[model samples]
Target: MDLNKKIRVFVVDDSMVFRNFLIKSIGQSPRFEVIGHAINAFDAERQIPQLKPDVVTLDIEMPGMTGPDFLRKFLPKYPVPVILVSSLNLRVFDALEVGAVDFVRKPDVKDEITSKQFVSTLLPKLLIASNSRVRMPRGTVSSAPATTMEARQLQTPTPRTMEHFAGENKIVAIGASTGGTEAILDVVRNFPANMPGVVITQHMPAGFTAMYAERLNKILKMEVREAKNGDKVRQGLMLIAPGGYQMRLVKRGTEYFVSCTIEEKVNGHAPSVDVLFNSVAQNARDQAIGVILTGMGSDGAAGLLRMRKNGAFTIGQDKETCVVYGMPMEAYKIGAVCQQAPLLTIPSIIYRQLGLLTK
Candidate 1:
């Protein structure tokens, strides 16, 4: 790949500093060029078609028509790759579920140090966005709010095979984003309630997490609930990070308890996989297993790699089973993953790893 070919990009953001900083950072990369820049969705609406950029960096919260609203309209007409640059808010994940290609966490670029730091991370996500293909519009997708059967039905499943686990009080930490609902449902349905205690981070809103948990609880044998501070980790139970907060595990002696904290978002996601995985790596070490499921971007790669390095087993859903293979691909490329398997085979893999597989 030639870094000097100038991969074209369009920037849609309300912040002048961010727009300037992003363009400057991309320009430094021998690989990217900013062809167009817009202040908000309305401006983007007029500029995007004319520029026809290969990649678009969008800010979800903009004045005069938000990014999501713009996406609701412009995406069907001109299907181009979009990478959302969002604040430290869970709402970023909501944009992803609506079909944004990837995301980058935006830091306040008031100083040169922060500006330089932002560029270092932003360029990579943009390059990845440039290389990837956006989902083609089949027709008018639903405008209904992110819940209801209509919303759930629109989710597409990523194909995967499973591996058997040895079965223990295996702590399984799973992460997902764009198309995680169905994947989590599939895995939980296959798992027996007596299966290991599981913790999950699905990019979702606060209200949505409760509903999702209730829905999953009705179908899967294991008990599912949104994580609250000081909750215990026990077999046959699953804890999901509530929207807008980061959930981690704190061990009081030998028992584990859920700890929730309000922190600046990392990787544009609250309840970020990075925070959960890092905490698990430090406290659980080899005793726990980390799994990164379907999602866009490289949010979990670093943390999962830390888990593997600390001797904990790590799993990444393979490309075939990922709606956007970005997260797993980044983890796999850096040797952070112990195994890469499809979704269906994941349960059995868990069983085998936990020594539950019997002849």
Candidate 2:
């Protein structure tokens, strides 16, 4: 591979060893190039403006100014994709909430496996972020408003066939890529404990989804956990597809559950949102609701459309609320989405449609 289209990366960490490790790893791959390295956020602040790298790998803990504080000051000014390299701590969540694109666990000095894993995990996100728009200032997240006619024009009748899916054993399936964890958590947290089963594919690496599930379970009214092979899709439970495996629906008679197994990537993702959504569309069809959330690619669009064709109700998170707006936008373009709602409203809309809640 000539690897000519290199993604320019800026490395920031207080540790020289880690910085050099990252530089070497990135250099070994022709797809990425290290443009600059900084020991702390102040140095980063000065150098970033000069380098203007396409992506930045930032350390959560630094001597003078922390990553989040740096982000508080720098993000508003330079809103590009930022991936946090951090230890397992509360700060990771804070970094996530602050709009860090992705995260990787820091590796020790002598651990080649861990270092390789971090490099592999980061490559995909960096590739995806390369095509993304520049970050806007914090608190200015909203985009231009839509015209009344444009809003009205976009609204379509919720398909009547979707009503039949409201019966027992119903499960809602969602899939997304870059910028999806927060999006999924925001939607899932709003559901009451007694809501139907939910399964999600968020394009995360091994070991991350379990932690994400644990985090969501703490805040959500319903149960949230990473899916293991043979896990039952029970009511009030949200199962996230574990990283490094494909999750599909296994139905025997009326009972259905998630089946986790290693499989090739579909649409550039293993355990793809489409794989799960399509399985539900095939097995649960009239008893499933498929949602396509914010992401950088068309991974879930075709599958959500398949769900619609199979008589499942379908929803797409609208553009203004999405971090990337690529996945939902594609689904909407194909007429796959029956209901398009902002992230905040999606939960209520789903609950209302399922008769789980009254308007």
Candidate 3:
């Protein structure tokens, strides 16, 4: 951890070609140094301890010992920040849940344009991973069982109660980055299927958001899918903003829908939280609920403030529960958050704010 020493990195991939490419690309940066590499988890397991690298870039699919398995074994012992480099797949999320810090999609090595694009996306993530906090994997975790909207209605206050607050028109907007994958799942899984429509913007590359949406749909009773250009925003459905694009809320008559389109990066990210929150500020106004979760930077702070100024109810995840407190901290500092809550409490807070519960 010397300030003068460049961050040392260890690369692990099954492909020798990719390992070399990564070493060359990462080594070019004066801030980083490629110390060593291994072909798979076994090789990495043997060499990593001796190298004592600051960061490790890993591959998801390998000849033996998949990335998630490696993480489950390695993190508990060594506790070094690890970044997964792979093609877009659901297993990437599984790895993140197990404890990998972040991920970068594998580029087409034969294509010059894609190779350059890959480096652009990777270098920053490498820097972020190096400084990220590594957490120990837990043995047991509990999640709320998925229930149908009707079943949820039977347990909570009736729709009659929510009708008084114009809850039918309410929309929830959530944004996150860095440690977002697990944090988002924790909040969303606790939601009842009858809750208001939710829109999420989690910083991720293209090709992975679809799988993320698919994964969420399997676990939550509500319909979940990657947002399309004109998908309707409605109760019992959650729209995750597609990666590599920007998603904004638009009103048609009395109904709300999302407009997902390719656009320049806002606040240093595509599918940015700022873009989504600003749209809610302009379109949904007081009918919107804005929640900013864990992340590395201030991407959503300004937009959350705008939402608050526009009379939207805003919440930020408390620092104690956040994996990285950057986004929520920034929002809280600017008076954007009307309330701050722990990760497990956020869903209930949203329901209460919508007048769905007496508590």
Q: Score residue 228 of candidate 3 by CA lDDT.
A: 98
Worst 10 residues of 1 by lDDT: 156-165
Whole-model lDDT per candidate: 0.77, 0.80, 0.87
TM-score of 1: 0.59
Give the poorly placed runs of model 1, Cα more than 4 Å off. Answer: 133-170, 175-196, 200-231, 235-254, 257-290, 294-315, 321-359
Q: How far off is residue 172 in model 2, in Å? A: 0.9
Query: Can you give the lDDT of residue 141 in candidate 1?
Result: 60
| lDDT tens digits by residue: candidate 3, 1-359 | 46677999999999989999999999999889999999999999999999999899999999889999998988877888888999877899888988888899999899999999999988888887887777556552326553554244324332223223547679999999988988898777756677788999999988898999999999987799999999999988999999999999999998999999999999889989999999999999999999999888999999999999999999999886677788999999999999998776777778777776665
Best by TM-score: 3
Write model 1 residue lDDT over 78-151, tens digit each, in one string. Answer: 87888888776555545654557766667777777766766776786677677665643335665656555334
Model 2 TM-score? Answer: 0.81
> Residue-wise lDDT of candidate 2 within 86-190, one digit each (tens)?
876557666766767767777775987877777787777677666654434336544669677446534522322222335437788988877787778767766
* Clash-forming residue pairs, model 2: 79-135
Ranking by lDDT: 3, 2, 1
The clash count of every prediction, one per candidate, is 28, 1, 0
Q: What's model 2's lDDT at 270?
A: 80
